[model samples]
Target: MSRESITPNGLNPDRETIQLGKLTVPRLFIGLWQLSSTGWGTTSVTRVRREMRRHVEAGYNAFADHYGTAEQIFGGFRSTLPDPKVVVGATKWCVFAQIDITRSVVQAAINERKEKMAYDRVDLLQFHWQDYSDRQYMDALEYLQEFKNSGDITELGLVNFDAARTDEICTQFPGLIVSNQVQFSLIDTRPLDGMGDVCNKHGIKLLTYGTLCGGFLSEKWLGEPQPDEYGGPMTPSQRKYLDVILGAWGTWPLFQSLLQTLQAIGGRHGHRSISNIATRWILDHDFVGCVLVGSRLGLTEHIDDNDRAYGFRLTPEDNAEIEKVLEKSKGRELVRVLGDCGAEYRRGGGHE
Candidate 1:
């Protein structure tokens, strides 16, 4: 499709677009981790497929998935869409198991992911290593680079990788890595400390998640009482982010204050929702290439609110309002406690 005719109905005019190798994707990607059914909640295949089609129709051409059943689920959904080639898919290869880092093993893994996703090639293949102590991940990347050169993968990306390690990888490989997926939000700004600079220096972009803090940053939780117990009717994401809010972010009262501030700012901008303001804040960051928004598929819909993020820009006064509250918050110290962008998962704590 020509660039002029590529715009979809209801697409926000101000939404930025970026080029990932040869694939051009919107600044916001539809996240499919919730489709795994292990964390968010139970999802029906029909509902998930319908939601996927809706996102693509809305011009959210790029989608993110993981190794497990997410790729398969996305594959099934993609089959139902018209001209699936227009939709860009991204999946990860988890390097947790100890396996021989041979070229054959790596090629087989890549082939398996492609076959499972019903695609000859993936737009982006992101690598996630649970234990950085192991050196097998480097070998895996070496093999992936070969595939990238041969056109099996369009781009290579990393998940939860720190600044120092990312720089080392870039230095050793030159221009192999194009992007890094990390958690970046109002509550978690660890990426700004070092990762941002390294990515900027090396021409690596960032795809950020957890910007909404698993719905904790939404209007639904504003002024609401904190849950007394950890487990209840809350989804796993909600339970996990709640911990960050209480632990890293600070007291519920302070969070409520932040929420009100966002609401007021959003009100000035066509009465946007809290989630819209939160997502727009992340998109405003220079290092961020895209913000991954978790979709519950047919379970719920936020297409309209999400589109609002691109409708208006935040002013300096608005940023100052958020900063004023953050100044008194413990988010900075929380970054230290959490270690780095993907440190929580590596250390087996925090929300992964």
Candidate 2:
């Protein structure tokens, strides 16, 4: 576990893989949400496949939360591997509208994913429900369970579901669900409220995203002035998380203080980058399973910097110092202000 002992293809196995049902996945997952749209920029399929190989060789073999042509592109890359099972791929079936939750409807969703991925069964199928009032998500989940029973899916998970519903659904289907994907970061401490306890009670693992706040939680933005949301080089993710930073979490000045604190903590940990410290803070929690880092693939990459996230743990002094800045902000009050983990999406703040 020492920093000097860590290798490129080797990492702390315990920290590298977390239990996700019967399968073990890397602690860090490569998120393909950027591939869902051109807002993050575009690249050739050849470069993307090359980047996927680089990630695998670098010890990150799990991928998730893709959309549009992401699944198909991932399918092509996965086929090139010697053994396809060497990688873990997760796809989503999001219901943003009110529709009948039929068995065939569920089958068709899975079928399309499988056909796109060129696999007979999906490695992981995450479900997202937009409207909580409809309650048909339960029906969809029930049918998803039926698919699992028939071996159409190896694992079932939730995307942007609140803690209350996560607890309820897990109780209704005991020992069925494996993971719940949610937004968890230093600024957005909503998961720390009730979601942590719910995950513990149900034996569920949290696949967390926005751990770096859409690349805002880094040294690049440490002392920089807040950019205008209307005119800037900010990506879609940056725009979304910027609202959380300046609007919900705290003022721009307070966030700068946090970044400084993180910088200091990173200095204590042998000058690890702010992103490493931020990700380490989340991975340190026992309830968390993986931190999903969004990568623009061919356009850009942080594989080496991100790889440094492992082989280090935050000390009590480090956390205490980080919390000093957090106390001045609205960090702990996010759950009350924004409801639960997925309230940002449900409350019309747009998706994470």
Highest-lDDT candidate: 2
Every candidate's lDDT: 0.83, 0.88
Candidate 2 lDDT over 11-105, as tens digits, reads: 44534778799778889999998998899999999899788878887888899866768899898888776578888898898888779989999
Off by over 4 Å in 2: 1-15, 349-352
RMSD of 1: 3.2
- TM-score each candidate: 0.93, 0.95
Candidate 2's displacement at residue 42, Å, is 1.6
Candidate 2 yields a Cα-based lDDT of: 0.88
- Pairs clashing within candidate 1: none
Tens digit of per-residue lDDT, candidate 1, span 1-352: 1121233567667767897767688988988888776556676776777677677778887889773477887887666555668789998876766677898987887888898888888779988877778877887888889999998888999988999899988888888988999999888889988899998898888999888988888999887888764536787677778889887778889889999999999999989999989988888877788999998877887887887888577899999999999988899886689888899887873324
Per-candidate count of clashing residue pairs (backbone under 3 Å): 0, 0
lDDT of 1 at 19: 76
